[model samples]
Target: MGAIYTLGNAAANRLSLLLLTLISAEVLDVDSFGVFSLFLMSVASIASISAFGGAATINSVVSKFYMRSKDLASSVLTMSMLMSVFVSLFLSALFSPAIYDIANASGAYEFVFIYFLLFILSLLMAVFSSLEGAVYALKMAKGLLAFSLLGLLLSVASSYFLGAIYGVYGAIASIFIHRLYIALSAGRLAIGKTGLHVSVGSVKRNKEFALMAFRRLSFPIAAASVLAAPAVTLALYILGKREGVASVAEFSIVYQCFVVAIFPAGAIGQYLIAKSKGVLSEAVNVRVQAAKYLFVYGVVAFLGFWVAAIIASHYFHGKYEISISSFLLMGGAASIYCINCSYSSFWSSLGYAWPIFYSQIFMAGSILLCSLTLGETSLEIGFLLGSVSQIGVNIVLLRLTVHEKVAL
Candidate 1:
């Protein structure tokens, strides 16, 4: 799941960065950029809450019931479906105001205010996530990868072409369709042969499981601040408030490369959940497989991204520019986080929810303070530093959970 998602994510992020960079320069004026920037920030932030952040727990529990209980898939599916609908409604409400404000600030068309409805994309994602959980439950990582890649392609092609044709509004249209495609395709599959279903009683019963799952995931989710929120905050800090939006947009594009890196490893972690419990029993095969994949992720990431960055810098021109140091450091930091994320899954498998859940302190600070502290003169440094705390927290948590010999 991680590898495939990473590839798809990389392609999409690169495309988005390229497209947005151009739009930031040629399409959006400074005020427009500010408005667009706010929308960008809200998309990530609201989606997290909107989804109710339940996918991982869904992943863990669904995996357990599917592989072990077999009879529980329908119940898990049912719970997922219900949660998806609830999350969408909740997130749509949360994001609507932000969209309105951003659009009002942009002073574009009145329809720009309607951009807040994009939260529907997030809500719809909750639905897709439920379906994804069903896929995860079935250990259908490859199928999930295909489903994700399809949506990614749709998003990439549509957004790029649409943005070029209709500016940000066109981009918005692409987003609407993207959500629809993902929800329909993945949702149908899970509900089809698998009979993935959800219910209210199951939601009540699984609340504890869900909470623990959230507790375990807080580190990773918070760690992600380095990519979007902190990056935006740091840009605003360093670049003078005037340049904040543009700088945020720029580094966001660059940092997305790191986010893309997580996909493949993430896919692997998702696949491993079914047998994750087997690790504690000194399952040599599982441990060995984990070790082998970790090494593979590292080697591929190191080699692949370095080359891509070089090409992006030398050939892409204007838009993809990054200083040599920033590029390398960013990639290295991303690589570190990737490995940590993989181990965090192992910790999760151990029933410990890895990174020892210490990231709570770091996540908040990283966003508000660490990012805010970066002066425009130090934007790159800020991007590199913010994720460090997340990486550190995960490392410690993984150590606490995994057997040393496990090579996590």
Candidate 2:
């Protein structure tokens, strides 16, 4: 039942973003849409860095202490938020120059400040994500779904209206507003509803514990996230350089659809992580159940993609027509990627971060290598190859790590 609500929350979240993508595509020119896509990709990467795996760590900690100590959970949340502030400032300073250069190169220099604003907003979104993890740990998925639905409605309405009037800036402002709403809502639910008290004094006292939590648990996952989150951003950067911004727009559209298709796998993976409780046996069960869900969902999602492709191509009047071959290749990649995620989540639950790190290394390396070698004409091939490489690494690592203890 918790899983069901989590899935619904995932669906609503993805649907909201998809609708915004379509709206942006409809309102903005192809090149502008490409820039918007780049902004979003940057946000994802920045959010991961700013989060520093605090979201997942909070989930694990809060779950472990939920029955034991609410004060500890509250303290962890406060610590994570403090970490977010420092990380976000450091990241903004570190990446701002590079972002400006990218904007100048892409002929979107005027929008650079908006891009920076969005980058800061990503950190706020990260904080929201941590709160959401706490909510999940508390089995408050129903509340999450309700808040997400409300946020979805607000975001869509705001994005559409603002996008039509102010172009990319307005669209981004909508995202800013939406993130604020979600962060506030999640904080309320995690702290207010749960009756968890967080304070500066609590954070001060737990400073050592916070450092230990980050060192022992969050650091490795953060490393893995730092690698994984940049995959799409790097791909887009390469594609924009190799092809043109318009091609980047087209690729972003397909990738957004791909993301929507794979939402179920991600939702399930996160739910498993929240529920697995660091037990290898339970993690194995999670992996198996995830496989079953993915197998059924993958088929339906691919078929849905095909129909969507046809309709989207017609609606856009060939402005964004996706080829059948591209659909098949990307669908295959999405499926393989789902498998990797399911397995990776198993390791994540067990607190074995090296496997996740290795998987990201293989996956990101394959994608970047293929993108550099294959050129724009075969970009989808890069996704396919990357997914294949990731699954291969995941299987080998899983077997080597757990072979003696678990029967395959």
Candidate 3:
């Protein structure tokens, strides 16, 4: 399982580089690239919204209920599908204007909608796909990684071929197809392995549990999405406004790579959490474990990214405006932010939503300021500042969490 997880992470990072290279070589232009980035960022953040913490919800509840009835998790997933749909539609409508602008930049109006629709769809599928968190919760990282890697290959290949021919639209369609395959394949396979079935009757019996999940998950995940809003806006305002299409693509390349720490840190942390629940039920200790892993994953993933980016950055040619010093600075800072994501997991795992909400809002707001006002020098600096802000929040949260426990 561990090895498989490692493989999946490697695949994910590799796909990022592959996408960057292909975009640089083929359809990516400066203004067009920035628009692509904006869509990608929005899609990612919105994906989280649609997820509504369903993976965690499934992980937490399935363990508790399946002891009584094995089919319990699958039934709840049916309801989760409904909730995800609600969130996805709400967000699409809420941000349609912003989404429209991003698509217009690429001169692909239909694509903008297609990207958002697919983004929401893939995200929705991911939730159903996450019902397999039970598989993960049960320590089947092998299966988890296998399905994910397959999906990644399909996604990368699809985007490359389709994008070359149809431009950004084709690339997005490929992603849609790839994720669609993963979502379906993983969900069906998990059901077979778990021997679970989804029935409306069983879900009806578990109505209270589903509602409870919504209560706990919706706001917190929404808040996390909100916290990221500033960074997206900063990207749009400074890079979209200043750098144009080509610059946008390069920035997207760099930014996405920098954010890769989110996955490996999440992979290790979630695997541990899934295994440790109930058996290791101390909130204080959970916080400590989270903080420690945050640092460990951050350091390792950070270094790996720096080397990869240095190697890949040269391949993109004149697409970027980043200097060596700025790259190093942002790279280091993003490493720390990845660490912060781990601590965030602690709060999220514990279902302590308000603190997570407030903290992220504060962090994102601070990043927006630096990016918009101080952005004239370079986009890398803005990204660096954003990373620093997140790291600062994590450090404070860690100290406060530990100190409060010690006093008790």
Candidate 4:
């Protein structure tokens, strides 16, 4: 039942995102949509980083201590929330000049005033998002699904109307409302279940544990955020600068849709990590089963993405042009990335996260190289090359590390 709820929540969340993207693309002008996409990508990247790798680190720590000590779990949550807020504010202030530059150039200076507010809202959203790690770690799948569904409905409805009437600002405002709801819902659940005491006092008490947690998990947490958020945003920003906002718009649409294709793999990976917390043989069997399913799903999903791309092009009334070849390549790349996610979850589960961190560095370097050489045309190509490189390295590491650990 937990597995069922987990997958269902993932599906609902992905579908909601898909709908939001579709609606935004449909309602906003191409240039406006491009800016909106840029805003979302940038905020997401920064928020992920600010979350202090909460998705991985918080989840792992919460899971470890959830059963043994509720006080410790609450302490972890308290410390994470404090750090999330601090990082968000610091980053927001740091990026203020750039935000000003963009607003001034775009003649949207009035809206620029809202940037700081948006940053706070986005940060709160991210902190709440990090709390989901506790939910998943605790196997509160039903509660997760319920909150995700409610958030999705709120996001879709508000985004649709606000986007149609208010444009980008309205769209962002709507997103803020959605995030606020999730944060409240997830917050209530976490506090209710674990009795979280998120005071400065709690943080002071847990400072030692927080330091230990950061020392242990900082590398992978930072690496994962760098790869997932900022790296992708940087790629898209470069593409937008060199090729045009239209190119950014096209690729953003493709990437978002393609992500849905690989979400099942992500879901399975999380499940495996959560469930395979026992005997060595059992963990190996879990990985084997996960691999088989991912292989089959990836093949089918790659084909399905091609078909979906065609339909999407028409559905949007040919607003943005997407090459079938590029679309398929990106889809294929997304599959490999999903496979890497599985290995990452596996490594994190076993306290061997540094290998995943190292692989991301290698992957980032490869993508940066491609961007430098291939220029604007390499966005989709980078996706493919980077994924292949990361997956290859992770597989070798997984084999060597798992065997060594098992032998020991």
Candidate 5:
């Protein structure tokens, strides 16, 4: 039941994003759409930094400790949110110059302010993401689904109307509004239901323990996330530099399909993480089952996407041309990524973060190397190679770590 609700919420969230992407593609010119895609990718990467694995850590901690001590869990949540504010602001400031250069290079100097706003919003979203993780840990997936659906409806409506009126800026503004609405709603549900309170005093009091938890449990995952999340951003950056923004726009469409394929497995992985109860042996079978399901789903999703691409190509008539071969490559990448998510989540549940970290390193390294060399012709192929490297590392690490009795 929890898994079902989680899957639904994931579906709604991804659908909203996809709709926004499609709307943006339609409303904006190819260059503008490419810039928009770059902004979105940059936010994803920066949000991972702002989160610093805090969401995963909070989910694991809240699941383990909320049953034992609500006060401790509340403290962790409070401290995590407070930490997110500082991290987000700091990273955004630190990266501003680079962001400007990228904007200028991409012929989006006028939209730099919007990019900055989104960057900050992405960090703030990290805070609420941690809260959402807590909500999941508390087994409130049904509520999450409701929130996701509401957010999706509102986001799509606003993005479509505003995007039509105001082009890329309107689309970006709609994203900001949508994220803010979801964040506030999630925060209310999490705090009101859990009776969690956060005050400055509580944050100060819990600082040591919270930092300790973050260092021990969250740092490696954070490292891994930071490494892994930016692969797409790096690819887009390379594309913008080498092949220009039009290629970025085209690749972003294919990437959205890849995201659609992976979201279900990611949702299942989140459910596994929340429900694993910090037990490796207990989760092994569940993880295997999840991998099996993902394998089947991946095959279907890939074929379905291939068919859809064919139809879309015919209908759009080169207005937004996506190479069928590129779509197939991304489909393959998404398949491997789905399988990897299950194993990565299993490792995370047992507090074994290094394996995930190493895998991300390989994944990022592969993407970086490939993007620099092969991205001129096809961004999808670079991503596909990276996905292959990621899964290979994940499989090796999973086999080695499955027998270990890791303490959480």
Candidate 6:
């Protein structure tokens, strides 16, 4: 039930996102859409920094601590929220120059203000979503889905209406509105259920879990800042430089489809991570089952997406002009990514967070190398390379989990 609710909600939300993108692309000019796409991608990447994996960290920490003391759980929640807002402000200021440069290059310099708004909004959403993860950790799937879908629905309605009238400004406003709803509503549910409230005393007392979470948090942010986020951003920049902004728009659409395909695996991974408890052998079995499920589902999803890509290419060919072949490659990439996510969830649940960080570094490096050398001609190839690199990294992580003795 948890898996179905989670996956179903994610799919609905992503579909709304896809629709929002399509409407933005249709209403705004290609150049504007390109800028919007970059902003969205930037949000995803920078969110890792602002969020610092706080959601996952809080989820892991709260799940364990709640059993012993709800106050500790609440303290972690407060600390996470505080940390998210602070990091959002800090990182937004830090990245202002880079944001301006990208905006100028995309021929949308004026949109930088909107970009910053969206960036900060992304931070808030990421931080609050960590609470959502906590809710999921407690197996309250339906409640999580309700708030999530409500946010998406509101976002889509506002974004579409505003984009038609205000163009880029309206589009971003829609995003901000959507994220704000999620942040507030989900935060409330998470806090009420987990007994989360601001307590300065509790914050100072719960030092151990905070430190552990911080240690786990450092790796993903480093990986994102250095490798994962930068690599994708660079690839998009390269594609824009070589082919034009329309290329960015095209590939962004393909990536959105990939997002839809991998979401189910991610949903299952979340369920497994939350439910995974007991002895080492039990954890091992959970990992094994996760791998098996992803393998089976990835294959099935690939075929479905491949077919859907063909149909979408035929329908959207005149307006979007996306290559069927490129869309097919994205489907393949999404398939591999599902299994990768499964491994990621399994390891994180077991308290071996370093492997995910290491693997992301490898994946980023591979994408950078491949995009610079081979992807000058085709963005699809760059994405394929990224997928391959991610799979390779997942394999390494899995091997380490199997062979080495970790005291999780």
TM of each candidate vs. truth: 0.75, 0.92, 0.83, 0.91, 0.92, 0.89
Looking at model 3, residue 192 earns an lDDT score of 67
Maximum-lDDT candidate: 5
lDDT-wise, the better of 1 and 3 is 3
Q: Tens digit of lDDT per residue, candidate 1, span 1-408?
A: 444543453344335434444444344444454445555555555455444434555666666666455345455555545555565555455545544643454455553445445556656655665566566556555554566566666666776677667766675667667767766876666666764555556546666654555565533443343234434533343443545344654555455565566555655565565556435653334545765676677667766667766766765466434566656666665665555555555655654543424553454455445445544325445444545676677656546545484454
lDDT, model 6, position 3: 81
Clash pairs, model 5 backbone: none
lDDT for each candidate structure:
0.54, 0.76, 0.60, 0.72, 0.77, 0.70
lDDT value for model 4: 0.72
Tell me the deviation in Å of residue 9 in model 6: 2.9
Residue-level lDDT tens digits of model 4 in 1-408: 876887787777777767787788888988778777777667766787788766566677777777787677677777777777787777666545443443334545544555676477768767876677677777876887898898788889998999999998887777778778877777777667565556677557777887777666655666666665667766766676677777777777887877677776777666666677634665666766776667777787788788877887688666788777777878888777776666666666665578777787766766566766785447778778878988888778776776655421
lDDT of 2 by residue, 230-344 (tens): 7767777878877777777787777777888787677777788888888888888878888777777877877776877677778777576557666677777887777677876
Two-way lDDT contest, 3 vs 4, winner: 4
Q: Model 1, clash count?
A: 19
Of models 5 and 6, which has the larger TM-score?
5
Q: Give the distance in Å from residue 324's predicted Cα in candidate 4 to where it truly belongs.
A: 1.3
Error of 5 at 400 (Å): 3.1
RMSD of 1: 4.9
Q: Candidate 6, clashing residue pairs?
A: 55-130
State the lDDT of candidate 3 residue by residue for 95-153, as single tens digits: 55565665554556664665467456546554643555556655555665666677666
Error of 2 at 323 (Å): 3.1
